[model samples]
Target: MQQGSSAHAIVVLARGRARVERSLLSSDVLPLGYRGAGDMAGESALVGMESYTENVIAMEDCDVVRVPTSTATALLRDDPALMQALVSTVLQRQAEAEERLTSLLFRPVEGRVVEFLLQAMSRWGVPDARGTVISAPITHLEIAKAIGSTRETVTVTLGVLRREGLLATAGRKLIVVDRDALAMRK
Candidate 1:
């Protein structure tokens, strides 16, 4: 959906990938995070907000379930445990956003890209004979947006990592060849 548009319901991703991004005045968008299967978006609706704080665009074909605001409110009202879980989720997301802001403020682009890759691996990577493989064919532009850098920078950093034998690619997937070495970079 468009940024700043009112959301009447929470869209839960049942499958596939989507990016949550914020538009800057310059017309550039910074990706806040990626939501895969089972992740929820438009959470502001649950709290009675009129609009979504970020724009959510599907990165691939996805299946989603829409829970209307009224239904979500009713569910929270009736179930204390659910409400507590929702509160916990919100707090966790807030903490993550804070950490991202800190990284953007202090870290170099290379460091940010490495950190983003590591986080992606932790969240979605599957162990293989080669290394930890992130199955998604994430584009350089997507990486750039996530790390607050340019696509050219991401491409160069990735090229450097590849030449250093710290990362590899097999078909569409990305493999971290040397996780320890990658992590050692500040």
Candidate 2:
């Protein structure tokens, strides 16, 4: 959905990935975070009277299930388990967002990029013979947006990481060659 629009329902990502971004101005858009399969977006609209604060853009073709606000409210009213799950999910997302903000405010570009990579690995990586591989087509532009940096900085930092034997790329996938070294930067 478009940023700043009134949202009527919660969009649950059933498959693929999406980025939640905030438009700073006409040309600047900062990515808040990402939602993969099983993640939900627009919960604030479903539970409260707030409009969507960010734009949710599909990183890849996605499958989503929309639960209207009325139905979500009704389900929450009638089902304790569903309500609990929703609360848990919202809290987790808030925590992640806070961490991102903290990193943006205090961390250097290298640290921020390393932290972002580590977090992405934990969320989406799969174990491989050599290292953990993020089996997604993530671009330098996306990484820059996510970490509040420029694409040039990300590109240079990635080259540094590659030289340090901390990262690699296989086709479109990102491989964490030395996860420990990467995590140490953060």
Put down candidate 2 lDDT per residue, 1-186, tens digits, no spaces: 877788788888999999888888778887778899999888778747568888899989999999898998898989999989988988888898898889989999999999989988998999998799987678998898888889999999999998989998898788999899889987
Tell me the whole-model lDDT of each prediction, alpha carbons only: 0.88, 0.88
lDDT of 1 by residue, 1-186 (tens): 667898799988999988888898998877778899988899988777898888999988999999999998999899999899889988988999998999999999999999988988988888988889987768888898887888999999999999999999997678998899999974
Model 1 Cα displacement at 117 (Å)? 0.5
Off by over 4 Å in 1: none
| Pairs of residues clashing in candidate 1 | none
TM-scores for candidates 1 onward, in order? 0.93, 0.92
The positional error of residue 158 in candidate 1, measured at the CA in angstroms, is: 1.0
Lowest summed lDDT window (length 10), candidate 2: 43-52
Q: What is the lDDT of candidate 2?
A: 0.88
